[model samples]
Target: MNHHKITSDHLQKKAYVYVRQSTLGQVLHHQESTDRQYALKDKALTLGWNEKEIRTLDRDLGMSGAQSEKREDFKTLLADVSLGEVGAVLALEASRLARSNTDWHRLIELCSLTGTLILDEDGVYDPADFNDGLLLGIKGTMSAAELHFLRGRLQGGKRNKAERGELRFPLPVGLCWDEAGGIVLDPDQEVQGAVWMVFRLFQETGSAYGVAHQFAAKGLKFPKRAYGGVWDGKLIWGHLTDSRVLSILKNPAYAGVYAFGRFRCVKEILQDGQIRQRVRKMPRDSWLVEIQNHHEGYTTWNEYLANQDQLERNRTQRPENILPQAAREGLALLQGLLVCGKCGRRLTVRYQGNGGIYPIYECNWRKREGRSKRSCMFLSCPPLDQAVAERVLAAVSPEQLQLALAAQDELLARDGSLRRQWEMRLQRAQYEADLAQRRYEQVDPDHRLVAASLEARWNKALAQVDEVRRQMEEFCRQQTRTFTEQQRQQILGLANDFPRLWRESATSAKDKKRMLRLLLEDITVERGADREVQLHVRWTGGACEDLTVTLPARIQDRLRYPAERIDEIRRLATEHTDAQIAALLNKRGQRSSRGKRFTGKMIGWIRYKHRIPAVELKRPDERTVAEVASRFGVSHGVVYYWIDRNILPARQQAANRPHWITLTDAKARELQDWVQSSKRIAKRSLKRQSA
Candidate 1:
């Protein structure tokens, strides 16, 4: 019969062997795989099993056994066991099958249902026995706990290392791992050169996207990924544009200092299958560890910081992809640098009509839908542009530079004098303070001396000292004058070179913005008749005075009003009763320059010019006779009689009276003549009465 050979009295059984590795560090040996099959086959043959019934599973190399669901051979083995295809299963250890309690329990359940026996190096386990099942469960539980404990211990060790600033993970781009230390520079300087090139390119193009595109087009390889390695725009741009990675280029850590735990994260899971909250960075002081001069550096700290500052300025001034073509052509030097003087808003360039012939800069904010209140008082003046450029160049010219350098020297000398004066004043104040303290200590406690006397004297001395200190501070502030003659010469050289440099050199939008700020102080544009325009340009050097155009009659009237009259108008407006005076003027056929009638709004304009505070007036009935007399410089009885007779006009009576009477030399002589004439008339009248 084709029955199995039964040497011993027990039934022979077929068994399968399964092997696995949990981590990349572990390797499967050919001998191990072959030996496992032979051992299981030998044991089965010894039990009188057929050779063909022996099956081995060894293809699942380097696969983890932590989760049964992920193990292919384990799943197949369980299925075969459940179908009763195998009577027994064998392995080197229980952990080799599964280190998770849940997975182990599932295996045990399958074995018991299929009546399959499990044999390990320790002993054979009969799943049918209650005691054996319990022992197996306990072993599985211990194994899983051991795995968890091992993981916890490993993580704890890593955290401790991080606290000591010795933790090492995968090195980021522009850095490499060192066997002696932890992270260091790449042995090849080519990568570092490339990194510098990237920074320089960013400083030139002002766009990370453009930089990445350029790099990719040039066939430069990006840093390799940890998994599935390939270079693409996203990866290239991600590394090139990452603020974190860029920060590393500017970080002092690689200069031989340890910096660790610069970031923290709060763990949170969202219902949408995403991690909502994570990796919140903390302050630098809160970092876990810090050590100075940790490794070799690719760039100096100053250069790195400068690059970072430049990058930030670029981010603010140049939006990504907005000026890609302009960047490529090196045009649009004034793209982000120009601003409208009238509206104090940024100006953007526009190309209109066919062939884009007309290029004009217009204020974006001034062109809003409802911005018709003022018909763009700002004018576009090309002469203003040329004038500004010329003035800037002239201001930085050799002679001008010499002047600036001289000015700087004068400022330095002034600063030194001021500093000495400040020191002297500070010393004097300290001495005074000390004297006050000593005097207070020397005073007799029993004497009935007024404390106010001492306080007054101390306050007076302190006030004097404070005055001197304030003068010194003001002197110091003034000491920050412009460059000296030599410095001005150097700056002039730079300024003279700027136009050419800006034209030829590859400068970023940020650089252009800085240049504009340094060179041009302000640009004022005025619209003339027939759409003609005039520009007033101001530059950094006080040498280039602001252009003063002959203003229109309307504007000139506002500017040239007599100071005294303006003050009077402001004072009257503040009295609030000036509204009646304004109404009187309106009634008298007088009107404002715009031919508009007077209103309360005009009061504000008048008051603002006069720099006077507004005041409320009392009701007419509340005006006392004394108060009316005081206002008009008349006797109370006279004021009352006038009020009773109603001789004076209501507006004149309500108006503020002059504080003091004044008579010029001519007016005084005229008054004397009038008095003499009146006396002669009086004498003639007396003679007639006598007759």
Candidate 2:
């Protein structure tokens, strides 16, 4: 290989000038680009090169030298040098040519192979010179190390500042850095006013999308983009919908707690061949810092929390398409009132199919389980046009209104009483608990007598406290029950008006199901044979009553009789324990007025039907005979005598076995009759009076 000896005179012979700035922050004027160009030209001339032969590389603005292969200007200049079109390469310094060791060495190797000379303001360094090349290598390594160190130092400083909560980034609107210098409220009232408007708008509209559209239509200018771009819907909506932006509005940070490090960014390589950034919330304990009274807050914490709850509710409610016009009008009243009868969940309204004509109110729980399961519950979707309007009209009736007012008053009074009672009981319980605690604390563990006494007292006090709390709860329920009848009347009045409203109201207005929900609780339709449909109307507050006021007398009669006969059978069953009496009645087979069979359920129903006196029943597991006797209001001797005498009926006697009874035939017959009659066969009535 024939190598040529390249010198400064052979290199400074290019015409092009390549100027570069590493970043937008680095101004070409500050670095004196013109001066550097002139100087490099002069140096080339000094090296016996003409001005026309001089070439300057200065087109690398907004470029970094971290990767030399990607620097377009550098690559072009190298190409010219390789073609021997350039005599020498001139720069202000070696660092300007390359800030990386690898790129520096590669340049040197190219220069040496292509017989190109390199010159800087400091000195001309020919690649052919062994000592000069070694010096250039050392300078290149130092340059690279300095760049690395600068980056490391910068990052370390940022991390330290962040840990101290002093690190500042872009303020996400509704906020500004403190004038004295920390995170603070924006001084511009206009911006703060806009923030307030966003919250108010959300509350009024009950929709983020609606609010965004309103702002867009009004041509509201979003906060000036920090990046110097015009704001569009994305920016406007982002500010309006951002959780952090809302957080700031709610945060006391404005009232002056500087909360920091609540979230962190994690970087990961995604399948799309790009690095993605994800944010994860940090725990409260891990928060970087919280300095109170940091700045003026735009809203109070309470107002902010309220706004958040409103936003959350809006998110959970039906979409615009699903919400009827009427519902939209009375949304406030019906927002959380309607509930599913089956799953005890809220029923959500939805529009089905393309035309959006098939409006339906469905239980989300049932829908999620699919159509088959939907039938398991009484699904009620009375047409929005008639049913809803009628229901609402009924709900707002004078009678209903009166009942509602009465119920509200009653409820308040009851609640007040309950609250007072609960407070009194709670105070007593707390006092007792305190006393027990103190006693427990005072008792020495080593002293059995003291410990035992304390334990017993503590147990007794706790038991009493529990009992009082239970009583308080029961009392509260009773207070609520006191208003139930009134609530029912109000509900009935509301439901009764629905049919009228359905007939008179406009179809468009009828689309408002939510309005119906405000007035009526539920309207269920049951399909029967012969194309007969039964409508059951349950008012908002009352027990469900069949609204089919014109039910066939026969059906009405049937319903009335089933319940009545069931009750009658239960009464008779309780009076008689005699299976024979039951059998005789079965043999006689007298049909109920409804012509339904009277079975064991009817005969023995009284045992389960009527509330038994607590004193009459023995607790299942009472081991002590005295306890059992006391529970039944019987003497212990009587209990023992019953056990020993086995005076139990034949069936019960069989259970007691040979140890208890030696029954004569006459005694057996008497016991049998008692069992049949469910009455004690009186000894006086018996022909043979044998003990």
Candidate 3:
């Protein structure tokens, strides 16, 4: 009955045996399952195939049978089976080959077409037989359903454990698992101090990079514990990187909270048809598990939340929301704090002029997006900065004394922190040296192999101690001498009478921006009247203030004379000449809008701009060329001929103006007689003796 379906033709092919496990952990712990799978080689040998022809596929061990996509050796097995190279496929159970119905049915179909025999602990059967094929189909379906049941149960257990805050995981640097299976602060005092100092400096600087800068300036090292290696359960000290600072800040374990699933992996298909998993950080409310106050914390829960907010505020180029960007180098005091009330978008700053001496703020979102042709508004830097500074100074004036005293205390505390870090480092080195000394003394000198090693280790530890001591000495040498108590009191006495520290050169523009962000949520600006703007300042606690600041006129408007100045010039123009008007303006101490003394050309330009007529200063006897020609009863050519011959005295108002001729009754009568006597005008003049 075992070989009922096995034929002589099938016995000519080789036999195949497949082995697999669902996970690496299962492969390590479940030896019986692996042994059972390997024992199938014997089954293959007995199923009408020679021992030399029996091949085993063990490369697929410790890999899941759920999918054939990533299983290389399993793919080889399928290739051989479909090629009719296999007389029989042997496993302890058919389900070991695949846990998915699709893969299981495919293998069964290939065997049936190739007329191969299937062998398991149950019995030997040919998939070509109708009864055996039907039975194999039932087993394939059962195998896939069993995987679902197993996966659901395993996941349910994990969720139950996590919900109770009992799921054990690796803790962050400041906390560790004690021998009693409870979370406790690290026993290393230096490590604890370094961690606490990071939180404190972050609060002071309000940026992650600033925290790292503090560590670098202090010449301090940060500690990280190793996991799952030869150096496991040991502290590793090295340079504190910005990325590490962010990791420490983002971790909830440092805040004494048990959190799970703060991040999750999502699978996506690339454009090239390959699949990849990307890790995305989930928001706080989206975390799967959270247990507050689960252990001692470096900061309170509220403080942790505040740190997150501060970190968010420090990011730039995040064009959404009303959060102000981190303070950076630039002269734009309202860099990230200004919002356009018209379009409700953030205003951008642009530096202009020679050497970028001028900064202008404007909102051009719609213009950039091609939705509008005009910008919302623009304001020059000086006036706007001065206005904001006035408001800020008035608000902060009442806190000067307190702020100055706090600054002194903060400075002292910063120095003390550095000294304490160095001291702790030296103490830890001393203890390590002492431990090495004890180990060396406990060893016997007769056993040279062990004693030599211990002695060398002791010497190395002592060298470390000496090196740290020298470093501390150098640090102390570089530190400024402390002021006497009386001197400190004298310095403090100027605190109340001191000027606004915010306006002093000691305060940089970046610091001013940071302070401004702390006090004001946002300043919304909209265009008001011509050359004016409305600033709606929103304080941190929901208080609002309105400020109206007049912007300087545009370049075209500023250079042109004012309306009243032009009117005064026009009233002066009807009575005085260009030169006379210039002299009159100089006498009255009236200067042009450009802060220069007005000249005749300046008055002429004002006339051109306003289209005002200049005064007629020509004398009644000083007639124009046309009037002289008419009085002499001759054409204008005859008059010009007389002037060209110096017979007529003519004057011009500069080169471009018209010419004037001098004429009197005696000269006119003589000119009329000469014109009648001149033969050139006798033929053209009607008043001549036309007869």
Candidate 4:
């Protein structure tokens, strides 16, 4: 070791010993490396720096030398070096100072400016000297390269192991690595049951929240395996959350697949401009390695894929996917099933009547896109809902549908409120307590410390057993009602009569929605006339059908006169006066739909609405179509054809209404001439000519 560069000025200032390890595992097992770093204090003393001048910056002991962001001691060392307070920076190696070139070079520049000396196990160097500064620069560059290579090699090996399905990472709760180094379902049956329950619930409910809610509602606990500290490899029971359920559903390990590179390490800049490394989840398609059927698992890969699709549909924020969402409480029976035929977008439901009781299916795509001032259409919901619901119920017999509870009353193969989990939990506690007691009994009294520790462990284990028993008692107490055989029989009977069960007040709208989804895939609605809607229904069995439904009229339309009455008034007004029409209506015992008696004023109002003229006022030469046909000795069809072609002079009040034909004796003779001249004019002409 050379100390020729160490001057009195350098020996007078404080000496900093920078110590760091890349990880906590290295700090615990690599004690020799830590001892070597601290031994630099002795080197500083031998270099003529007194013990007081030697400051050990070992606070960075379990931290990385890659960057100085999280290492307080490293930052302090840099601060002291920049301020010329550090006469010498002693570390076991240049890498200890920094494995990042930027940090290392910055330290070198500061050391050169302060005229400080850099010391390591190799020797001492004056940063102010040209040759020494060059050597320090090369060493800093080499140290950075070494760190990069080291990381690459480690990561490469890890990826290699993962590709072969041999890599060992922390398994998700329901899985664990066995002594033989193969992935297997956790040996704890209780944990297995809980995990199975989550998958089962999600499958039945088609919702992550539904699974979690089932757990909470049943007063059940979920299992989590502790990864580190004293609780490592121990089962942790806690309340299940939707997020936990989602993790379980999403984990491929549960599906018996080994996957690696699910997450990538990324360096992020914080608000304070400090660099920190974090992990970001990668998409499944971006995963580096995947091995299916790696071991026995809770589910299959196909089921996992289905679960993923179900989750994607259930996720609220997935705007790209317009798949039907989980059934919710609403009056709109076709909530997610209705698609706008015009705009080809999902139609949303809007409630507008008093207390929002009336639901209207509205297509707000145009409005949402700022393309329209109002929604595209607002089809009344009740008519459509009832129409489709009746058809759906009628398509199949009562035996086809089986109304089911959203969640089973008993969880995990009907284990009854996690009774199996509690019993298993208590058994494990008792086993541990018994084992600890045996260990204490075997230990000699002379070794009081060992015996006392064993005794304490036994007592703690017994206490845990007691706690488990108490929790089980409380859970049992909370469950007041048990599902009975008669009740089960009633449910079966309802299944036989599905419509009655579906119409029951106890059946929720959400459940009904679920029931509807099972039979029907989707319904495309096209708004037709103001009084009707066209429905294009697609069933799950791949059959398609189109139906038209009559919509309920508006308040005003409902109060208006019936079409039959209007037609009757139009017929009577052509020849009869309003007074005469009223008299005839009364004589016939006819009245308004509202039970009002016929009156002249009412007859006049009906005439005005229908554009009916009173007493077909015509010249003496004019006659009705029937009269014109009779005068021509031809059929009314011939007279109508002549009127349509303007051949015969006629006057029509409106389309499809009565027309009055003008007939002079000369014009009637001309029409008779055409009927006698044309072969096609008479229906019996062909048969009569042949005879």
> Largest TM-score belongs to which candidate?
3
lDDT of 4 by residue, 1-691 (tens): 3367777888789999888888889999999999898898988888799999999888887777888888898888888888889899998989888999989988889999999889888888888889999999999999999989999999999999999998899999888888989998778888889999998998888899999999999999998788889999888899999999888988999999999988899999899988989999999999999899989889999899999888886765432455677887897888888878877777777898689898888888778779888887888887888888888767654343332331334332454647777888889988998999899999999999998899899999999989999998887776435557687567556555778768889999899999998888788888788677899999986779998999877877766888887888888887887778899999999886467888888888888877877776667767899887665566688788898898989986545557888777787677777877887765544454556
Off by over 4 Å in 2: 1-38, 61-72, 78-84, 98-117, 121-141, 158-179, 182-191, 216-293, 300-691
TM-score for candidate 1, residues paired by index = 0.41
**C-alpha lDDT of all candidate models, in order:** 0.60, 0.58, 0.83, 0.83
TM-score pick, better of 1 and 4 = 4
The TM-scores, one per candidate, come to: 0.41, 0.40, 0.63, 0.60
Residues 25-100, candidate 3: write the lDDT tens digits. 8899998899989988776666557788888888888777777767877788778889988888887886788988
Count of clashes in candidate 4: 0
Question: Residue by residue across 306-408, what tens digits does model 1's lDDT show?
Answer: 6555555445344221211222222233444444556555455566649875455555454464665543553232444454556565665677766766777
**Candidate 4 ranges with C-alpha deviation above 4 Å:** 1-13, 46-51, 112-117, 123-134, 339-384, 394-502, 523-537, 541-691
Q: Residue 522 in candidate 4 has what lDDT?
A: 83
RMSD per candidate (Å) reads 27.8, 29.1, 16.2, 20.1
Candidate 2, residues 1-691, lDDT tens digits: the string is: 1114444446445643445556756654456754675466665565566677766676676676665655778989877767767656777666677787777898888877766667666666778679878987888888788889988899788768766667786655767666556666566787777777776676555556656666777776556435454533123333343444345444445544566777887767768644456898776577767665545666565565565555555455442222212234322233333454445555465555597644455555645667454532322234323433454565567776677678778778878976897888788897997899798988778999888888888888888888888888877666654446766676566555655655555643423444454445554545455434444556656767553322234445554435654554455544454343346566777554456655544444433545421112223432355543443344456446655666632223123222222345675465455534643323322322342
What ranking of all candidate models by TM-score puts the best one first? 3, 4, 1, 2
